[model samples]
Target: MKKRYILENSKSLLVLLVLFFSSCVFAQQNNTTPIMENQFWKNVQFGGGLGLGFGSGYTDISVAPSAIYNFNEYVALGIGAQYKYLKQKDYYASHLYGGSLIALLNPIREIQLSAELEQLRVNVNLEGSNSNSLDYWNTGLFVGAGYRSGSATIGARYNVLNDKNGIYGSAFMPFVRVYF
Candidate 1:
């Protein structure tokens, strides 16, 4: 009985050892490597930024969020949204909603150039005045350059929002974004 017990336990231990070695080899073969294949479609990345603008009696802050579906290594297109709130003493309390189309050109592994066209709609309501709310449509053009790695990007942009009655500015905006 003692000899039989030892043989059965030894057989079980050998099977366990074989499974561990096979799993280790499989894991080594499946190690995550940076995807370098030139394919027509790749994994998509999404991110956004918060920005502030100041000029000509307007002080506004914006949250701009974006998403990109990478079609290849050299080209991608994205859709983004922006919302801005403005405060200027007491003249107007304003809200703006906008959307943009982004095009990206990658020059190297860590650098990219982007161009965006955005359209915004602004609504203005006067404080303490029972006046009708005013609304207008405005368009903006943005051009920027960026640097990126793993899951973070930093960029600088120059933007021009059309000059309308109460919502227009040109700004140099520097922003950072993170991806999960």
Candidate 2:
């Protein structure tokens, strides 16, 4: 079952990547920051998100490690890995693991348009007499706009494939990002 999910999503992911890069290739060029040839580090960015929760009732934690490469001022491509865990006392625990591909378009300073695709596997275990684990694919496509300044970014995204138990958890997800 897991293998079928991966195989099906793999084709979809590949098609999306091809289309995304083709669009980037045709983006109109504008006067923007010039790349520093001597430093490859300058063209690369690294950042993601960390989520935490601690209390008597429930706990949630997540971490994502990401990298973005600036092909030009108007276009950037990125990738990340995500891991999330949630537990509810005497109830259930869920684990989510995924990889993401993202593209960012900056038509003007301080404004960003973004698109992302994620392929994830979610495992849910219910604590009961017949404890069982369910594994399935949770694929998400997110599109939104953002405000970017220096190394910080704030954005809101809508997941088109918003499933009730998907990774994003809702149709809308707010984001705060930093790149180094």
Best by TM-score: 2
Candidate 2's C-alpha runs over 4 A off are: 1-12, 15-39, 129-131, 165-167
Q: Runs in model 1 with CA error above 4 Å?
A: 1-42, 51-61, 128-132, 160-168
Question: Could you tell me how far off, in angstroms, the CA of residue 152 lies in candidate 2 after the best superposition?
Answer: 0.8
Q: Candidate 1 on 87-160: residue-level lDDT in tens?
A: 77668878899877777878786987887776677888887678847787655567888898866768888765
TM-score of 2: 0.79
Q: Which residue pairs in candidate 2 collide?
A: none
What is the C-alpha lDDT profile of model 2 across 1-180, one tens digit per residue? 654575488668778877886797567356434563435467889998899998898999999999999978889888899999999988889999989888889999799889988888899998884857788777777898989998888999888777565556479988887878
Model 2: C-alpha RMSD to truth?
6.4
Show the lowest summed lDDT stretch of 10 residues, model 1: 32-41
* lDDT value, residue 37 of candidate 1: 30
State the C-alpha lDDT per candidate. 0.70, 0.83
Model 2: worst 10 consecutive residues (lDDT sum):
31-40
